[model samples]
Structure formats: structure tokens, C-alpha cells
Target: MLREQGSAIRNTLDSVLSLSNQKAYPVWESVNSFALIKAAEAGLGITILPENLLLDSLLHKKLRLIELDGIDMENKMLAILHKDKNITQPLKIILDNISNVL
Candidate 1:
């Protein structure tokens, strides 16, 4: 499968693979989504991508959309901070609200 490396999605996929005890030997890996999609459409291999990214490509009769059962397709946003930084109650509340929406 084609994997977009160095992404949160890839990290999530790695977690899923670890939990499932499955290993993937990808023939292609890159950060370019367009190239990855093209490769998939060209029959290179399967790739996991957000539905919103597949809108135009799905219109092609030759391309098929396959859902990954039990997998969340939503993009997860992560916030990182320094170790010395303290999260105040207001900041925590705001972060919690934002996280809940995601």
C-alpha cells in the first residue's frame, strides 16, 4: 500500500497495525497525496485517504472506493507544547472543546 509518511494519519495507521499485529511492506511511500492517488488509480496498490480528497477521482468509473471497516477517516489534529508549559484551566477547557469537535 502507498503510505503518506510523516503524517498523523500514518501514525494512526501504525497504531492500528500494531494493535492488529499486522505488518505492511509498502512498495511506495511519499508525502505527495496527488501522486499517491494517481498511483492507486493506476493500480499500483491500495491507499488510505480521506473521503474529501477522493471527490473528483471517485467520478472515474474505473476507480472504486473501499471503506476500511472500523477505521476512522477523520483527520486528527494534534497539539504539542514544551515540557515547561503549563496548561491553565481556561486553556484546558478550550483544548477539550476543540478536541471534542475533532
Candidate 2:
């Protein structure tokens, strides 16, 4: 996955323009932190995000974050679910997986 850099991989027209020595488009402008994470999740590109954002069940299997040679931004993720819904056996398995991974 790519991060919010001027010369990273992106699929927008502005990103294309920037490659041709033209001005950048605001919609294609890259931001730091969660903006990169959100964009990656949306399939715009892959990225290397901090470990902390993957703490919740919603992200456990939905994405895969990679680590490189010397990165030091590991973190945790936290989430909350409804209390009234009956916890099913399959869901319990998913929760167990989340706990084991994070």
C-alpha cells in the first residue's frame, strides 16, 4: 500500500497530472494518518498503516497491514459493539480471532 506522499501510487486524474509536471488536484491531495488508511480501505491503493487502527473487530479481517524493515509506528485498535444482540457461536469465533491477533 502507498502513503500520503507526492510521488506515491494513486489512481486519480490529479495524481496523473502531477506526474506530468502539472498542478495537483485537491481531491487527489494526500493527507496523513487516517486519510491514508481510509483511502486504502476504499481500494484506492494499498498502504502501510499503524497497527493500532486495526484493533477493532470491524478491521480484523477486512484489511491487512504490512510491516517493513525499520518502521516503528505500531499501535492498538479498540472498538465497541451492541450489547443487546445475542452473541452467536460464529461471532464468538470471530471475536476470539480478533483477541488473538491484536
Candidate 3:
């Protein structure tokens, strides 16, 4: 998931380096957003993630952003529901919540 629509995350990092004229550095990868957030909040290291993932944390002053000037991107994800299966009220509510968040 670190790679956005098409390696956008990695591409974004490269672009940041190019723009800043900074030295190349290694980046740690995480399997999920929760892990990334936890590691970053624990002072492990900084990270670049979809802004939405860090919105609440930033609002509460739990995390900060390192601006990459001139960069603009949106990350998208898909959830598929089987058409053959009946969607119950609970499932509908869950799907609605997910939709609303995105």
C-alpha cells in the first residue's frame, strides 16, 4: 500500500529529494497504516502516508507533516462486496461508514 496508485509514494519521495536537493536516504517500510502510525509516534522515524490517515492525529498534535513543496496527490482504495451475498443491515452500516470516511 505504500506504493500509491502506481508507485506514487516512492515516486513522491524521490521527487521530494530532487526538489530539496538533499542526500539520498533509506526509508523503512511497514505493512499497515496502524503500524506506521505507531512506529512514527514512538519516535522511531518520520513517515509519508496518505494525509487522511494522519488527519486526526495531526489535529490532536500527535503527528506532524514534512512538507514536500509542489507535491499533490490522492490515495485511493477499493473494497469489494460480493453481489451474490445478501447485504444485511449491519454490513450496510459498515459499508456506509467506510464510504463516508473516504
Find the candidate with the highest TM-score and give its number. Answer: 1
Give the lowest summed-lDDT range of ten residues in model 1.
1-10
TM-score of each: 0.64, 0.33, 0.56
Q: Between the candidate structures 2 and 3, which one is better when assessed by lDDT?
A: 3
> Runs in model 3 with CA error above 4 Å?
1-25, 78-92
Candidate 3 similarity to native, TM-score = 0.56
For candidate 3, write residues 1-102 as lDDT tens digits. 243323555566666667768734546655566777877888887777778889978998888888766666555567787889899999999989998988
Q: Of the candidates numbered 1 and 3, which has the greater TM-score value? A: 1
Question: Any runs in candidate 2 off by more than 4 Å, and if so which?
Answer: 1-29, 69-102
User: For model 2, how does the per-residue alpha-carbon lDDT over 1-102 read when each residue is reduced to its tens digit?
Assistant: 443454323333335455557843343445565676667668776654445654452356666656554423433455567979788899889988999877
Q: Candidate 2 versus the native: TM-score?
A: 0.33
Report lDDT (CA) for all predictions: 0.75, 0.55, 0.70
lDDT of 1 by residue, 5-94 (tens): 567667667777778798656787878778888988898888876665677889875468987788664555788888899999998999
